[model samples]
Target: MSEYYGTTVEDIFKTQNKRFRAEGSEGVDAVFAYDVQGEGGGRWKLTIKDGACATEKLDSDDFGEYSVKITVDAETFVGVTIGKIDGTEAFTAGKLKVDGQIPLMMELPKLFTKYAPPGKEVTAADILATSESRFQPENAEGLDITVGYNLAGDGGGQWTAVIKDGTCKLEEGLRDNLTVCNIVKAKDFVDLMLGKLDPIVAFGAGRLRLVGDMEIAQRLPKIFSKFKSNASEPVEELIMLKKIISVDMKYSTGPTMGKFLNGLKEKKILANVCPKCGRKQLPPRECCAVCRCDVDEFVEVGPEGIVTYCDIIYYASPDPLTGETRETPYGALFVLLDGCKDREALWHLLKKEDLVDVKRGDRVRPVWVENPTGSVYDIIYFEKVR
Candidate 1:
């Protein structure tokens, strides 16, 4: 038997979990190696302390506290391993194993930079270049469009542009033939492409400049909004058709829900039940929609529940906190807790396989957190009774 004692992947995960729970630190020191079949492979030496990780290309002298060395076939490394890097299958398949403190291993997801598809940046650049190229035509379709100003870098200047017969062109004296149909700073344009800004504010606040017909400038917002919606479409065909563009729109950050999330870290389940219908709400709310009454009474729920339904998410959302999509699918379920006889249930993410086998009427309990916060996110989720 391979006796992985104090320095094993499982131990690393466990220790990291304890450290995170006890001190809220996701720090560790580790060495990891990916053997890329016959071509060439390298190792990564990582040092993590005080919740920060510094990694470097490894050498023979590079030995660390925790280590993972994976050797697989060359074809497997190129096809399977790389694919697993894009998804969470490597961890699930045991192809990617960790050796060291288990708790720190668990924190790896938070520490590591996720891999992103390479083409997005190129697509954004292409969109800008293509638009600029198309707008630099002179005397097209007899449109008397004129560029009133030619200010480069910040796009701050007045320009007089005209439109004729459904065609627009920039006037002479303007360096570029394109009149500003919509004005946006270069930075704001990048932010808009990354889903970090709103179009209305970008234009209204003068962060984006507008020229030519006011009607065209006004219609740009609607057009850009539709363009954004089309860009977000998941269909491969639609994605190829929709060119990526940049804009300047700032997104306001909502209040941090960290404390509420930390409550879940403590393993406490907090929920609100409807007084009239007796429906249990997982994310405890102040008002019950069905009963239209204030749910003043808070109650403790379970660490267990049945997996009602779930969907695998491979795509990333605009929400920044979600980070990168994990390779393993996170299971979400609507669990009916024990002692809540009113058929009321709370929904949350499930962390264990026992939850997968859970059926109706299965006994469940809440894994309560040590410290209680008066928030619904205090309870991570319920686990099934043994």
Candidate 2:
């Protein structure tokens, strides 16, 4: 039996779990050290104590303060730290060197269990099964979605997804409303599912591309953020990544916007008509300084429209409502309603390619969901009638 600081890793994990279970406590005063091997013959020290973890250069003066020391062969340490093995596997590989308390070392597994990664090898069948087990009325209330992956990265791979309230049965080489894409690798696919990569980043970086539902790209981040890992990764590199792209989409909506949303539920399109030029606005407004009139009329607009402009979407958000980000290249169109004039365009999903025949005056009709609630979303969007 070896020791870690004055304890064993396994024992530490057990004690921590017991304490957490009984008293909802984390570690009180504990310190453990690891000699990690780098890509070269280099090594580093990773220390955790009093619920804080840190990494340092191998030969620093900080080594004197560690309470427990675990030395391992350099190669083994690198593999373990980089997620190549479990604690037990590392020990069995003759790569672990524990010096402290054997009892604490024995508890290492229990502690690691608390920080376990999400399950590996989640197949399409596995996700479908989980969806079935967790099926609820609320989950089925919104849109019906299908997800697929092209693990080959060549965009010529089989795709699978779980459908809500519908069976994904392929008949005569046709699937019902199935969306597909050319994915290159499973890791990239999983990153998309986990919302780690934005649709734009994935496509622009040559990771993934969309074959359908470009709006799903914008909604994917919101959906995947719900399942984000509780653990935090080292931010040294990530912070630099953030600096390169400085746009964040999660903005707060105040009480005024809340009122406007309520009005949309009543099937009224509220606009902030400019008093100066008498221009009917699209998004609602509070004041009109040009004419200095408070435009508060809840106007009823037509459910028919024409496509004025459109763009493709291939990105994900961190919000949980939208599931994993879809592949790149879905259509978003700025629609001009039949009865509204003066830049009154509604932004919503359009099931068309950017290179399609749609232009400034394509006829379109609002595709309303059953039992409209008057919310702007009450009508999904206007689709080209032809």
Candidate 3:
């Protein structure tokens, strides 16, 4: 039969028993007639009484006594039945004509749930097309095997899946040297893939016949993910939280950090030198970590430095100072300043435009603000010294 939007005119009437709601027809007695014109269209009658429904296809022009009659072209008729076109809009646009009781016809939609076109039948071609993507190379490691499928009946085709050394390749038509072969009807294979039929049950019932290696047949599940039906599934609304939390707090920068920020106002990098071991702290520390000696000597490092490491940040977090997120694809750099050595890399931001061109050991200089505040953000960011 010809179809429109994957559904034929006869398909709508054929699904009446499956879509009927007896409870909705309580205390209702009516006959609904449909006169669909054009190719692939016909007249049908629906009688509802005593919480039951009876459907009939009329061969003659007689509609008998219908409480309501609807007339429309085949395309619009199917469109309205499957909810592709709004019934109210179709009537208003003169695409649909109604006669008899208007009040009874208004209750038609409530009598049954909305119609959906039955999903297209899954075929061997469809399942095999997705086999490579669903293959689990980790499970197939160190294994070499050829699996052949000989699906019979409609929508069936021969295919071979070859798995070797952590990779899978699918070939059309069966191979003679298959390690294992599966023989089943195309419908059963589709049902098995959809989890609608059990392999154990089909095999026990002689519906599935296996040839060649038996162990390899059992290992098929481990080599591939479960086939997901392309049919539409119901979706539920997802819960979401939309808010930006702003915290108000402050802490005093002690002597060590205060001195470091003060140096940025003059476009200088400061470091504290440990007297005992001579370890340089880029952001000045009060005491040496290794030597356990109190550090007091301050040294000016570099406004220019070579990058020791760099991170191209794509996902950015909110800036604590501004309470806003930075634009992405920015670079965070760890620079070894001129006067500092031996792992004394200072952490700082890099210019966004220079992220792609900058690399380790590339010299960079801090771009200072016009009017500097004694904050780390005073220097906008370091730019690569091209």
Candidate 4:
């Protein structure tokens, strides 16, 4: 089918303009242009003039009066428009490249209607059962690999994709399922396809597990493209959907631990040292795991430590604490405090810039907020020492 059903781009703009007007034209007067390539490749611009929207197909890269411009493949543009791809996530993922007014580009999603490409009811079985049909032989070119999906639920069903010399055939149940298997809840499989969930975070959180042939699992992203479906407004959860749960919490911090929390206000690192094992616990564990004795000796270790392990979080769901998500491309790390040994480590955040330079054994320190609070939030996060 013609992308967006032939001659529909302008119709989309008209509809978008109506939506913008209803929302009282949130942005300043400006021209927004999309330089699209691939399948439905073309240049189009939507201009906001005196609170009204206008559109036209452009003939060149000469930006003209446009203040914000983005260039992306026709497929990705359609995915973004249809809500299969979150606009901000696509930009961050480098699928959408932009120049000129960034703030305006960021506002475009809110100015227009969120569209869902026709098939919103995609289920886990539908995705796996149709694997052979959904397969792009060209992408599988020069490669042969079998993939298996172990999805759980009422939609629960086993599926297998047998690939040989750039061709794929499907099966209803597992056969060599462990060749390269993915185990996930049927619902999460739906969210993964719909862009409501981030795969990297899912893997990190153990919600999605891949066993055997990890390299093949990583290739999954490139081998398949966006699925075509229905057109409707995107949901309020176009970004990341998370539940806001509130509860009362209380914890017992006896005399020993209480002193440590009080010392945080004075900017001291109080680690409980186990005399028997000579290991220090930064959070001040009541007892050492190795020695099996109460940690009585307090030793000051660090507002600084060395990174022992880290991973880049390119995508993730909302933070459970604040009900909000942090910007992507941040790092999650394990740091070993100075003067601390026996593999005792503290986990925290790292900056994007430091991610490239910081490595195992590289020193880091914590960033703190204005007022000192006994809770963990007293220190904002960790950063590279240099």
- Model 3, position 296, has a per-residue lDDT of 93
Which runs in model 4 stand beyond 4 Å of their true positions?
1-11, 24-33, 45-57, 62-70, 83-94, 97-110, 114-260, 274-279, 286-297, 310-332, 349-356, 365-386
Q: Local distance difference test, per candidate?
A: 0.47, 0.52, 0.86, 0.75
For TM-score, candidate 3 versus 4, the one ahead is: 4
Q: Cα lDDT of model 4 overall?
A: 0.75
Ranked by lDDT, top first? 3, 4, 2, 1
The Cα error of candidate 2 at residue 141, in Å, is: 86
Best by TM-score: 4
List model 4 lDDT by residue over 166-204, tens digit each.
888887788853569889999998788778899998999
lDDT by residue for model 3 (1-386), tens: 77888889899999876687887887789999999988889999999988888889999769989998999999999888877889878987889988776557656766876677877766778998999999999888888999999999998889999998888999999999899999999889988888889999999999999999888889899899999878665557555674667787698888998999999888777899999888899898889989888999999999799999999975455665554666666899999999888799998899988977888899999999988888899988999998
Give Cα distance to truth, residue 262, candidate 1, Å.
15
Q: Itemize residue pairs with steric clashes in candidate 4.
A: 114-234, 117-229, 117-230, 118-229, 118-230, 119-229, 119-230
Task: State candidate 1's TM-score.
Answer: 0.30
Worst 10 residues of 3 by lDDT: 314-323
Best by lDDT: 3
Clashing pairs in 3: none
Summed over model 4, clashes come to: 7
lDDT of 2 by residue, 29-125 (tens): 4455655433333334434455544444555534565555777754454345445556666665656766654345544433343322222344333
Q: Rank by TM-score, highest first.
A: 4, 3, 2, 1
